[model samples]
Target: MSKDLEIGKKIKTIRKEKRLSQSKVVEKLIQKDINMSRETLSKIENNNRSISAIELKAISEVLNMEIGDFFDEEEPEDLVTFFRKRNFSKESLKEISKFQDMVRILLNHEKIYKGE
Candidate 1:
């Protein structure tokens, strides 16, 4: 995949994983007094335009991820599905417990049952 598409897909993936819509992001920016048009957000997500460094930083912060991690790519498999398959053992339980978020907890248990 092209770099832009990869980034775009990652952006969309993370957004959906977090149950956030573009309007929600826009609303968040509004709350923070940082505004961007929905068209601009769409373009950035569609790889139609290159996102600026400042925008990328802002997006990373808004999405609650380190900027560097955004660049990681996977094969054709869906990441949420892939992560769901990985089994968590007793050793991994302690680490998984640190995940306070609902979806993260569900995915962690899923991995544990899947015997990954």
Candidate 2:
């Protein structure tokens, strides 16, 4: 399956697991004065459309989850190894640069993975 679809499924699963309906989520967003259409929210939850950072933050907050929680996915061991390798490159400066970027990205990834 496509990565976007996989991510969408995760979103749907989490929403269901939390017993939250699409309308309910929209209501929460409305309370925050965040105007979001039901269809737009459905597309996001289904991964039918790319979500924006602000929208993601809104959803996460409404769901009581971290922003990264939406992107969390169960990756294969090989992929994990590959990302781990990318975390640090050879050459000292290069390694530091790569690690710095990784720290920023993975900090969000890890928060979602941990469901915190």
lDDT of each: 0.74, 0.74
RMSD of each: 12.9, 10.6
lDDT of 2 by residue, 59-116 (tens): 7788788866656556654433564576643465456666677877888999999998
Q: Residue 85's C-alpha lDDT in candidate 2?
A: 74
1-116: candidate 1 lDDT, tens digit per residue: 67767777787789889999998877776666667877778887888877766777778788998999877655665444444468656555544445435656798899999997
Error in Å for residue 52 of model 1: 0.7
lDDT value, residue 6 of candidate 2: 62
N/CA/C clash count, model 2: 0
Where does model 2 exceed 4 Å of error? 1-4, 73-116
Q: What does the lDDT come to for candidate 2?
A: 0.74
Clashing pairs in 2: none
